[model samples]
Target: MSRATVHFLLRSDLERLFTTLTDNQYEIIGPTVKDGAVLYTPIQHSEQLPQGWQQLQAPGAYRMTRDNSQRYFAWANGPQALKPWLFAPREIIWQAERQPDGSLQFSEPAQPDRKLAFIGLRNCDLAALKLQDQHFLQGQYRDPYYAARRKGLLLIAVNCSHPADTCFCASTGDGPHAKADSEQPGFDLCLTELDDGFLVQSGSEPGDQLLEQLPVSPTTENQLHQQLQQALQAAKQQRALPSLPIKDLLAERRDHPQWDDIAERCLACGNCTQVCPTCFCHAEGEQVSLNSAVSEHTREWASCFSEGHGYMAGHQARPGIRERYQQWMTHKLSYWHDQYGRSGCTGCGRCTTWCPAAIDFPLEVSRICGDDE
Candidate 1:
């Protein structure tokens, strides 16, 4: 394929090309700050990044100030999401040791201690990592620990140029700018932070071998139309609402009375699908043995607003709290776009800033789609 042209690195050669890609072992990841928020860990240099920080979300706040500006896509969506370090809220997947003559060995759970690169990544977190690469790596049930951390990761994307006031990603088409044909070619360097430096591109083949190992330059069709007119006027001044056919209003809000007046200020509290960067749901457990020898089988991160994720056999399938907040806001604004054709809300509002009751999904979707004025 062709489109990979714009390139230019200087921000001190993109911090010596990410400290020589973290001295070649890769693991980098990015955005920092911790505890008082901002997250997306694993940094080890560039002075543990986040210098001067810049968070500031809304609807049930999240602050963090200062922005001395080393520009990395300034700020927006935080409260930690990038989906629990690529889909992991807990894991163990295998272990069964027993034996002294009874026999039971098992094993199987090592791979993944970091090889990634990540960095800055946004654009509704690369459209929620292509919706968890279509539910656990091209679905049909495959998930080998998210396909070995999605094949030892690399993506570097970034391109958001700020948009948060509960951003709407221009109404779910996905993001305040990041489209040069995205589709899980999980970027191997895509940056944008314009104004004078990074507009790099490359997509695969290890982002053309990490752009033949950086220090790149060539980009002048008026600096690639001024970084695509500052990522389309910062996604048209960060558009906020008006777009909710949410797959035909989640196939006509199954018995909607505004889900019982938004379930009395909803608090089934799955902190908006755990700060959804595209919730993938999870849960599994087992950790036996004390001399029967050993046992372990794990998986965490789950919630249709918890309640034993609908326990079973004796019943629990959505038993109030307004039916698990109307099945997680109608499977995220409508049957997750009728079972994933898209629109599972990448409007990165970090679910109204970690919803402690700021429950404002665009003012409950304009009180059930009606007042967009």
Candidate 2:
């Protein structure tokens, strides 16, 4: 946690880091360009990382372009976050079988048997992971599946130096820079990629052990200063949220015309929730065998925009797109504060960048609250 413990890692040594993780039997999952978009995927070597590639993102727009710069993680974020790695999109909770005596037997599914070392995790996404932990791990009834996957998870957080057009972590206090401490429920190691090398700090005991195995030199004060400056510059470059209190603004503006305005532009396709790192809604169903002798209960990711999401016994509460949109926004911006003592959104801007409608929530908030400045 001390600045004295920070170290410098040369660009060439990145391969060594990956090798070390692989030697420790950790599956290395990091960012790579695939199918014209930056996505988190499995990587065996450091070369698999999307180096010198940057992304241009806007409302309803995303394009990958070459940056010519030697930076490895210049792009702020990709479509995937730490969510899927922890909370699987689809998982079988339990299965049941017909016994020999015509009785039913049920058992929980086996947990995944892999230790994951997640690389290129941004600070905002890291915060989202903690928020998810609050929901799945810290609840009265803990989610066994999520807990099992989270147990051996190692987070390697990257400090943001290149923010996207829609990013606003600066306003949400989630991040443009990773928190420089290990005591928090965040990354095991925090990395700041510089022109020539990376400024690395251990946030956990495993991170310290990994650092011990790597070829690294003590970081200089000048390098640390530059790291801080770059992070601050990234924060400055990101879009700023409205000056008004967001929770209060949304709470009082339930009847505001902005909901209707957004509904008009919103496709209700649920792309935002799907890409959002913090959205944890899911639906469970039981699948029966043809003979109805065996059944498997499975849970998969669900969206608030789904028409059935608001259905009751005989009626639907949010039958209209406007109500569905309102529910999504209000739950993210206002109700989440009451439930978790924090806003649900991390300001990572994935929703805006990937949305077909290009509906930027921060811009919408600014317009709704009349905070032009």
Candidate 3:
């Protein structure tokens, strides 16, 4: 669809959007303030959203403050992305039961049937979801659970007009502004928040239907120009990538000394992977009853920082924190390109913000790549 088809929604009618989704039986999940941070939570109405709230995020630090600017989503990105909602942290893949004849019966567990509509998804998160889809849905062995949850998934992407201090989505080419192409696997509806209203564009058929129900009018050319300018300004405020080619630089810097430096400050707490939108590493194990009568196979999110993650027959592949951290960085920045034809990271900066050790990835990349030059 052309940009001319885009519409403008008055700020007062925001609640109508929520009501429309609810009327369609779509559970709206959006950003809300909870426990001193903006978190993605279920919201029944627009009032539940974090209004006039802003978050200051840096390595090993996060502070939420009141903006009082009438902006509902002044915060860039939060601790959790779309990952936890789509790919559950802990899920039972299959279950087994003991029969009277002493034979075990195996059956797949029922998947969640809830219809989820993600509101306020940033452009980078939409890209991360696509990357995740390549692994879970497009792979040879499709995950039935993920497929079920993804079937009726709805995305309402919000363009990043206020990039965080730790954000580098502009450098990674994943965000700052949501993609406008209708053919892309992007948002159903993309919204650019202006001072008084939103410049909204629909990317899919369902989004068009929703837009038809909203109180909106055709967006003016001047409004579209201002929207583009705001996105450009946001991109300029984000952290920039290093001058060197990251994929090649990291691939060749396997033995860089900076890895050891990072390992020293690293707590191996797995907070980075936990908050990373694209990190999909997981481990599966079986839970058995006391009498071993029944066993349930379960899968949960795993971290490369975990010691046992790299365990083999008799030894750990990455016995040291240096090796483990190196493996994670390499896989995310370099090897992922080889496997998926794109970088795994969306540059949301959640990893740096949530890390207790305050490890900055952009600084690390510059250190390693710049040292070689």
C-alpha lDDT of residue 194 in model 2: 94
lDDT for position 63 in model 2: 90
Q: Please state the error at residue 209 of candidate 1 in Å.
A: 13
TM-score of each candidate structure, all chains considered together: 0.41, 0.95, 0.96
> Per TM-score, what order, best first?
3, 2, 1
Clash count, one per candidate: 0, 1, 0
What is the Cα-based TM-score of model 2?
0.95
lDDT tens readout by residue for model 2, 1-373 = 3533788999989999999999999999999999998888889898888899998989898899996788889998888878888889998899999998999999998788889999999999988998899999998989989998899888998898889998999899988888875457377888899999898888878888888888999888899899878977898855777777878887787788888888898999999999999999999999999999889999999999999888989899999888998888889988999999999999999989989998987888887777532
Residue by residue across 224-259, what tens digits does model 1's lDDT show?
Answer: 787778777767633365555655654565665776
The residue ranges of model 3 lying beyond 4 angstroms of the native Cα positions read: 1-4, 371-373
| lDDT for each candidate structure | 0.74, 0.88, 0.88
Candidate 3 per-residue C-alpha lDDT over 1-373 given as tens digits, one digit per residue, 9 for 90 to 100:
4433778999999999999999989999989999998789888989888888888888889998895699887888888879998899999888899999999899998778998899999999999999999999998989888889989889999898888999999989888988886477488888899988898888888888888888988878889899989987899855766767789989998878898899899999999999999999999999999998889999999999999899989988999999988988889988899999988988899888999999998888888888654
Off by over 4 Å in 2: 1-4, 371-373
Minimum summed lDDT over a 10-residue window in model 2 is located at 364-373
RMSD of each: 16.0, 1.9, 1.6
Q: Between which residue pairs do clashes occur in model 2?
A: 60-358
RMSD of 3: 1.6
Pick the winner on TM-score between candidates 1 and 3.
3
